[model samples]
Target: MQDFREAYQSTAVEVQENDIQDNEVELASPWQRIGAVLINSLITMVLYVPLFVGTAMMGDSNGESGVMWIGISAVLLLAWGIYQAILMSKTGQSLGKKLLGIKVVTLEGDNPGFVGTVLLREIVYNIILTVLGMIPFLGVLISIGAAIALLVMIFLDGNNRRTLQDMLAKTLVVKA
Candidate 1:
């Protein structure tokens, strides 16, 4: 047991050093990316269950409950941001990123001075998309376009990773 522990730590140090030696970013595989997304989404869904109920409580067949829905949504988003941020800090990756073997690092400025590129690239862009989705018929078109653009960015990335938001934030989805 003692020998195995030493081996694991030694291996970890070697990998970290190699990352520095490479001089360029090392990214994770695409399958890991999908896994991480699935994991994170499942966690988020469970967290938002009560929030969903609250939103529904304020609505009915007639329509939404107006400001209440908006407030519930805001709280839900805030909760999501905090949760993702905390997870990113501790793991250097969210559940999805961990599954994908990717960690978020800022290639550019942490202009907002937030930890974990996932906070900005994932949480912030989500907000923008959500806000855009609130519009009329145009909102739907914009949402679809934005989603397509994000996917295209990922496809065009060097290793089938890094969506538009990731590129914009100068972050990488790298192997753990």
Candidate 2:
């Protein structure tokens, strides 16, 4: 009877472990994720440059243009943030994600919504990075370290190819 009990317990433990492993959905391909990032970066740059230059060039010597630039930049950023937060939260797909046929979803494969995934999970990191970027040499060093760490984590993760941001967000990127 003791041997029978031990065998049952071992089987049960194995089953539980397998179930947990199975719950992790298949991840999107690395190339897809990279493509999404590139597309998003291009979009951001397109939106940023024209507004920044236009505002800067429009201001006179009194610094009105500078103030205008700041204000306009703030507004543009807010709008872009809202757009991303809403789309990602509601659909689990940003423009790039949609284009690449990938999605961001919760552990249970549900949309995490704007407040949970976008604002808290994603935007919070962006805001932190922006603040950090405003600093001098230290900021640049930190950014470099962050980029290296992100790549390392994604490549080296045995369970999933999750970057630091994905881990922090409690989200998964999966093929659609």
lDDT of each: 0.65, 0.74
Q: For residue 127, what is the lDDT in candidate 2?
A: 85
TM-score of 1: 0.59
lDDT of 2: 0.74
Candidate 1 overall lDDT versus native: 0.65
Give model 2's TM-score versus the native structure.
0.71
Give per-residue lDDT, candidate 2, residue 70.
Answer: 62
lDDT of 2 by residue, 1-176 (tens): 99999999899856654553587666888888889878988888776764677566665574666666667767887787788777888898888988999987765666767765677667787788778877888898878887887767656547467676776776667887
Task: Return the clash pairs for model 1, or none.
Answer: 32-100, 36-96, 101-176, 102-174
Give TM-scores for every candidate, taking all chains together and pairing residue i with residue i: 0.59, 0.71
lDDT of candidate 1 over 34-138, digit per residue (tens): 677788878777766656765666566634554466567678778777877777766567657765667766443122235446556767788888998999888
Which residue pairs clash within candidate 2? Answer: 59-65
Best by TM-score: 2
